[model samples]
Target: MSAKNAGSKPNKPADVIETGRLWQRPGFLIRRLNQIHISLFYESCKDFGITPVQYGVLTTLREHPNLDQTSLCAEVGVDRTTMADVLHRLEDRGLVKRKPSPTDGRIKIASITPRGLKVTEDMYEAMREAQIRFLSPLTPQDRATFVRMMLQLVEGNNQYGRTLLKHFD
Candidate 1:
């Protein structure tokens, strides 16, 4: 039987299936939402003279100082080349420092500078305000729940991010 005609007959309710457009697909919805969120976030951060990815890298380094380049790349969800470019820019700006790891000659550690921390502090309120506006549909409790759900979606599914990374790589 042809693939299209194979399921032409509808029997029991359990065996019946409905077909829909790509816009109705869950994966498409998730991807579209992510695109919208990232675009808005990047635009909001532009006033701070930093892209969203750069802000993320800075935040990651601030939270986990002295992380090596490889680790930072993973944490920031960026490729090796892009991470290198970001590190170079941040280093040039005196926002981050790269030093050879004392224990390993092959590894270089990244640490956020005081200037970077100060810049983050200055932008913190603005960023928070933008986030609030973005999530205005959600109440305070709903906002917290939404964030928790989003984290769970990203971190809970191992295959989700790994599969997405393949396209970028």
Candidate 2:
């Protein structure tokens, strides 16, 4: 021991070790990745002024056309309240139109407007670029593996999620 340190106690460890461990935790990493992707999406599609969920809703509406809000909720993997809010926002933006169902007066069927379709199409490249950027750090093979594993995890745990995903044939 050095002369100056002879009477001193050894230094205590930090209250919490800060480094790779937290970053490696699956929940933390997944949450962080989601945040990063959202940032990338916003950056790439800033001009469109639409969120990821909105884009998904618009795309689903474009495909299904005139789907009831409940159906949209299932297709978009969101709760009824969230779907309702999103629909209101899109309708205010004039990107979607909603009308009462003829058979069921209480239900509203939603359809993407021409403007919504155009916006969705225009935002395609940007969204694609954002996805590419998000996976850019991985090699081609690794990217495929990563995506496959992600799908597997999501599928396996789907039942536990708050949102329900509608499976497509």
Candidate 3:
């Protein structure tokens, strides 16, 4: 099917459809790319003892400091339970500081600690390398178009995700 027609439901009878054609599906390709990206991210970041999600949280907090936990969860595109667990781990490692919000006693505000900032800064090159490697197979023009299209897809279907991305910047 053409790219524009790919999203439509198949008109063919399921009994006669070939399952092997799954390889050509966009969802399959995206899932495979996610697997590759995770592998490459870990291979490059293994020395730092941080997972991809942890790094994302650290970087997000670094950019937008003192975000309440709920807001942080939205910004990081994760559920509240996951956010709490991540924050607990970061707080235990002293990579993040969390405290009760001044105005809202029940809310916890999170800030990246000095060590977290340093770690994020130090991991910048490795992260950049991992991203470069992920897109290494694509030509320069293809890479740009691929990224634009991916962003378009994400924005078009953002609400379908379990957690909606909330961008503050």
Candidate 4:
């Protein structure tokens, strides 16, 4: 409701949200929600000194050992250039090692080091805490519903993005 309709009482959270009309804008809402999630993640996992992209790369490598750079980039849903930078940073930190693929010889392969696996394992709780905090405002049912809706949206629109995400199948 607008201030005129608000009846001079303090504006409740719902009223303020209604006034903004941001709820109707899906892109704006998605970006705003991403910012909130990133903030919560940074606050909870700052000690780990890792960003979500870095963690994704690490975890992808952990799951699929010796994946070539091109495949890893596709799986991680990032451009090759950005993936290269993340890989370089991880390599410099001694968390991952990159070498030529044994089969192809020319294709660069990446695998997480023991240190990387240890760090990723240790970060599980902190990241889980961040996820919990991000969804804390939602009821248990709403949380499940929200996640289901998100998956539907992503799966329906995956073809539009620059990077094609890998399917588990």
Candidate 5:
């Protein structure tokens, strides 16, 4: 199948895409890029001792504090059970605290502790380094263009993204 017409399956042969074939495919390239980015992020962020998902949650909280578990899950693109588990871990580590929301006693509100903010801040440098490492091959001009295109694509297709993305952004 032509790369442009390829469905979810690997390029027809499954074994020979190295000839600049699958390299031109969006879905395949995007997945491969995500893998590279995640690998770089994890390898470079080990000292921060936080997973990528946790980092996303932490940064989102930094931007919008006092969000409830449901909101946090939506913001972080995690399912309820998984969010609950991660929240529990953060709470146990003293990085986050949850209490009954004043507006709704039945609902729990989550917030990053001062320590969590500090830890997140400490990780910022490593995050920048990881991002740079991931895109190191690009020229500065190309990097800017790539980021602009990516943001455009993301914002333009936000409605089609898994979890809608707004809950997190």
Candidate 6:
């Protein structure tokens, strides 16, 4: 039978099935959802005068003080150049400081200033609320399960996560 006739019929050979348009594809929907989620988070961070990545860096530094640039880069999943740029911006804003390691001149340590901590603290509630809103559709248990599955998808293969990070870097 012709392809058009095959599609119109209910019982057709599997080989006669046609590929759907991109908009109707499951992958496209998932990608669009991710974009929406990122846009929402980015917009929320704008009111605080920082990008999502910048906020992540500040929060990471707060948790791990005096980390060297290389270590900080790894922790934040940013490359050396991008991390340096972010650090420079933060330093210019007087929110972070980079100092030569006392014992190792080759290494530069990064630390969050009081102002940085204060800014992050002020945004903590907003970040929490944003997360709640993002996950509002899911029950507590469903949210947990969703998070677990997402982590697995992102981190299951080391190369997969690294590949995704490369785009951001």
RMSD of each: 7.0, 8.7, 4.7, 5.9, 6.0, 6.5
Model number with the top TM-score: 3
Q: Would you list the C-alpha lDDT of every candidate in the order shown?
A: 0.76, 0.89, 0.88, 0.88, 0.83, 0.78
Candidate 5's clash total is 2
- Model 2's alpha-carbon lDDT is 0.89
Summarize candidate 5's per-residue lDDT along 48-71 as a digit string, tens digits. Answer: 778888888888889899999888
What does the lDDT come to for candidate 3? 0.88
Off by over 4 Å in 1: 1-19, 160-169
Better lDDT candidate (4, 6) = 4
Question: How does each model score on TM-score?
Answer: 0.74, 0.85, 0.86, 0.85, 0.78, 0.74
- Sort all candidates by lDDT, best to worst: 2, 4, 3, 5, 6, 1
lDDT of 6 by residue, 1-169 (tens): 4455655755744434334556645457669977877777766666788777788889989988998888887777777888889999999998899999999999899999999999999988877777777888999999999988766655655464432332221
Question: Which stretches of candidate 5 lie above 4 Å from their native place?
Answer: 1-20, 167-169
List the pairs of residues colliding in candidate 6. none
Find the number of clashing residue pairs for candidate 6. Answer: 0
| Per-candidate total of colliding backbone pairs | 0, 0, 0, 0, 2, 0
| Tens digit per residue, CA lDDT, model 1, 35-110 | 8777777666667787677787899898889998878877777778888899999999899999999999888899
Q: Per-residue lDDT for 5-97 in model 3, tens only? A: 468777764533445798766678889999999999999988898888899999999989999978887888888999999999989999999
lDDT of 3 at 18: 45
**Evaluation by TM-score, superior candidate among 2 and 6:** 2
True-vs-predicted CA distance for residue 30, candidate 6, Å: 5.8
